[model samples]
Target: MNLTSAAMIGRINPEALGASTLGLALYNTCLMFGIGLTAAISPLVARERGSGAVATTDAIRRLVHAGFWNNIIVVIPVWCLLWEAAPVLRLLGQESRLADEAASYLHVMQWSLLPALIYLVLRSLLAALERPRWAVVTGVGAVVLNFVLNWLLIDGHAGLPALGLLGSGLATFLSNLFMAGALSVAVAVDPRFRKLRLFQGLGRVPWRACATLWRLGAPIGIGIVLEVGMFTAATALVGHYDPVSLPAHAIALQVASFTFMVPLGIAQAATVRVAGAAKRAASARAGWVALMLGLGVALASAVVLVTVPEPIIGLFIDPSEPGAQAVTRAAALLLGIAGIFQLADAAQVVLGGMLRGLQDTRMPMLIAMFSYWGVGLPLAFVLVINNATTGVWIGLTAGLFTVALLLLGRWWVFSSGGRRPPIA
Candidate 1:
């Protein structure tokens, strides 16, 4: 969806793309809150199912119910923030026009947050149950739906208004709504998932279950916010630096984010696989295998980013356009830097997932805080003062590497020789 938006908006102008990118960054930062909180569903469900506990099915259903409530709780404040995004961006030192444009994007795009987070909760449940086929199908369909909507709405095809960035935002909103509804139907109809009765009692709060989710999920949510907030902060900082840098950074980051989804999926799978393991050695083996798979995919992604950045950048912006040369050049450089950190980024996320399966989140949250803020943000500030956009990415790379190393060490300590953390 971002790629589609960026490509179409870039055709309008670099400034438009920059504004939209900043809006997206802001929206995603807010989204991390819901994502982090609901992430507990998978690990909790997986562990319960693996434990052979009585009424495990009921427990898992209650977790999913709590997850939906949690989503509603998180989205309320996020919507408020996004509603005032223009002022917030201006306060962050963004240009007034850019901030307003970004805010307009957010006003419409923010509506997608609830549905998107709900989809995540459902997807996580499906993944935990190992009934992920429908979720996958729904996601692919949503992407295609988003693309067609983008083409029609962004440029006003089929007599539609040329909504530009607003159109992109609307497309996202509708696609997410579709995703959430489609997945719900899938869960309802599929014989395997229907028995779970995931949506049976929407009104029940399940206070104990909700409290348990918060206790375990808060650190995970906070850790994600810290990490995503760092990147969002970077985007804002780059936007403050120069016009071209914002769009450039957005394009590069989009490409990197697209690739990161590979390892992200592996990491989620790792969480489920490790959580389901019956023994310590089995868990250790699952973690290591997931890590290896993630590293291999990251390496392949890095090579592509390094080898053919221009072509990739071209996909988002017109290289032949006179105004785009600077943006293209800057994005290409940033893409290379992004490539350098692929392994670190992949390792950190995959390891983080493994640790989540172990229900070891609080320390990882501190590690993320220290790595991204204590280290990455400060270094980026120093470097950006000297090296412009390049400095910011270099600092980001350093932070990812630091977090990855720390997380790996943490994983080793758990896998080595110690009493395993109790499953919640």
Candidate 2:
């Protein structure tokens, strides 16, 4: 999508930027919003206080059942909204021929949105069920499918007429459909999912338990939004920069997402571990569970990027492609800051998850607001936008570093001596 946007933005007028940006941001948001909300299961499982010994399988079954239905809330709106893409894009301020083309892409892409949501729900279910290997396999398959279909459809291969951006959207939608079906089938046939029939319908979840999830998951959702928005905002702010720079950031941004996938997994593990420990009533262990995971991944992400920077980054940007230099510069920027950011980046994300495990989100949200908005936003405005790539990266780093310290410290205070009882 980033690459697509980069390619399109060059010829479009300035009016095309807002709808294009919002469409990409919010449409992709359907999945992130679900994944963030679905994270409730791990912490909820940790908090189970039932006196009678429930089988672990039963606990997991209930968790998956609860998670699947909850995700529907976000998924339903995503595809539905696509029906109005033309009007919506108009509302977002797209004018001229780009508006019509953007609308076509948006509408076509909507069909794929719900399937991605399904993938997120399934992935979260696996995490709640304690099965990362399955999750990983399913993810790899989705990536491969998306890539192949993208090539075949977008360029009109195999005697099919080329569909352009709209075709790309169709390819994306089909790939997601393929992935969602596969993941759902895997769950349906799995001994674990079958035992619970969690997919049968919503399982029995206590009212308090439902409330507990919203309590934990809501701010985590908002925090996820703010954090993602912060960077996406960087992308947006850059939209106001040179037209070519926007696409440059787009290519760089996509590459960064893949690199950040490592920390993304580590953060998931931390959220799960903390929840598991909380279930066991081990606060100290919960903290360490998260800390250890972050540290373990920190070296791996930084070390590899630090060691062989160019080859890794260069793969994303082909020099022969027009405007590829922008991609190269963006990739280099990500590479240069790899070490400076990931440790704190890892620490911050893990700690945020740790807080989610403890059902403590308000504090983290406040810290995020301060770090990203109060400090990060203004700093970025001064350095990056004003100077155009001069100090924007520095401010972005400053914001991330602030987030790491504040959230980890927040975790420390509670884990050390706070009155909060360990979840049963």
Candidate 3:
């Protein structure tokens, strides 16, 4: 939704759109570690709820507490990165002007980091507890809020000053802030979650539990960095080509990301379901079911992109807009490539979620590094130099395919062996 809003901004002002995308890319990547770290909450909470070792509520409370504290622990460094976003992008060879624009946006967006991470924990907890509807409700609300705020702030409606791209960042920050507070309150007041007493013993650190979370989750975070970084790197490569290339790449990527939300939601469901299924019937079979369901939706999305790429691209920017032809053309090309690899992307994401449910992060991390950096990045570099934007996305498709295959193979092996708990 945020990206779509930014894409709309691109229609009015391309530079702001480019800056917003770059700024958001930097923001998301910087928060990757924290997001990954907190992801342990869902699987861990699910496993504990399944085990009945201690009281379910007690176990969940501790896990939630530990996850919350871990966020606090990680927020400082994440904040530092957000604060220094422009310098980091500049260091990575991003255009100085674009970097400065991204930095200006990040300056305001950084304020949301703590709240956003908290929101993540809340969502993870809700999903793990099978109270995902609450999270969904909150998410829908946030998207709505984001859209309204973007309209009001970005374009300076109702007697407000037009803040442009910076307005987009501020909208993101405020919407996230609203989400965190709303979800937290919802959990606090709800009878189901109230028993967990999440805030009751907030002072207790649970250092060992947190360390375990870090142990399991940091790899997930690293894996995220590896995967997401490859795309960000691709964006950087595109940014070097020409002004049109960056927004074009951003538009195509955003469209692909928008489609990805379907699989992403399914993947999240898969994680919760698989984790809950733990030692039950073939974990592999359960994983396959999840993978197939996600793939089905992805295939449908692929058909849409393949058959009518122009309309999808048009959603971001009007074909009739001046200077939009080049962007539309470029985005159309990327979307077609995105269509070809859509299933692979869906498969990998669902598989990753299933693996996370299995608490099998290390191997996946290794595979992602090997697939994305080892195969994907090198290919992208060579291809971008030779083929420009087209080459980069082709490389992306290759990386996604490779990762999906390796992940499927690993799940096949592990699920074949035993009902044993997943390795940490």
Candidate 4:
């Protein structure tokens, strides 16, 4: 959906593309917090189901319940933050026109946060239960729906108003709503899940369970925020350049993020598989297999990015446009840098999930903070200050590589007969 929106908006104008990119970057920085919190649900549920206790279903139910409450608690402040995105962006040194345009996109898009988080909770539950088929189905459906809506609404097809950037935001909001609803229906009706009554006790607060969630989830949230915040900061720095730079950065980052979903899925599967393993050997095996698969996917994605940069860039913006040559050229260079970092990106994310299955989040969180803020952002600043746009991505590559190596070392320690990290 993001790719589609970028493509359509890019065709309209570079300014629109930059505005949408900045708005979405801010939105995603906030979204990662919710995602990290909900992520605790998968390992918790998976471990519980593997425990062989008769109350496993009840335990999973409590965790799911707590996750929904967590989402509610997290969304309120995030919504408030997004409401003032324009002011915030302006404070970050964004141009006034770009800030206002981005804020307009956020105004309509912020409502998607709650539903998107809810969908994550449900999807995590389904994945942990080994019943992710429906969630995948619902996700694919939502993407298709988002594309159709983007077509009809973004350009005012079917006699509708040409809402442009706002239309893209509305399409995303509606698609997320559909995803939450469709997944809810899938869980409610499936015979495999109905007995669990995952949605039955929304009004009741499970204080203890909620506490457990925060205890385990907060570091994950902070870690994700650190990592995503680095990217967001980079986006802001890029925004300080010509309009072409921001859209080019957006296009390159979007392509990287698109390829990342593959490894991310493998990582999620690794979390469930490792958490469910009855023996240390089984857990180690699961982690290794996931890493290999993630690396393989990363290699293929990197090859595509390196070899076919122009075609891919063309997908997002027209090179034939008078002002698009600079954007396309810049995006191609960034994509090449993105390709070089794909392996590091895959390794770190997959390793993070592997450690997460052991419920080892705090150390990873600290590592992310140091690698991104300490290493990546500072380097990016130095490079960008020298007027090197591609150097900005090189800094990102360095950061991802640092995190990957550090995370790999941590995973090795855990898999080599070291003491298990406390769940907290």
TM-score of each: 0.98, 0.82, 0.95, 0.98
Better of 1 and 2 by lDDT: 1
- Tens digits of lDDT, candidate 2, 389-422: 4355566678888999998777777777666633
* Model 4 ranges with Cα > 4 A deviation: none
Clashes of each: 0, 0, 0, 0
Off by over 4 Å in 3: 52-54, 278-282, 318-321, 418-422
After superposing candidate 1, which stretches have Cα over 4 Å from the reference?
419-424
lDDT of all predictions: 0.88, 0.63, 0.83, 0.89
Off by over 4 Å in 2: 1-23, 49-52, 55-63, 77-103, 202-212, 278-282, 303-309, 421-424
- Pairs that collide in candidate 2 are none
Worst 10 residues of 3 by lDDT: 413-422
For 102-121, candidate 1 gives per-residue lDDT tens digits of: 99999999999999988999
Full-model lDDT, candidate 3: 0.83
| Per-residue lDDT of model 3, residues 1-424, tens digit only | 5665765577665666777778778777767778898888888877766665664676677778888999898888778878888888888778899899889988998888888899988898888878877778888888899888888888899998888877877888888988999999999999987887888888999888888889999999899888888888888887875556777788878878888888877877787777777465655677889999999999999998888988776766756667788888888888888998889999999999988988889989999999999898899899887789999999999999999999988777767774444587
Give per-residue CA lDDT, model 4, range 104-198, as digits (tens): 99999999999999999999988888888998999999999998998888889999999988999999999999999999998999898899888
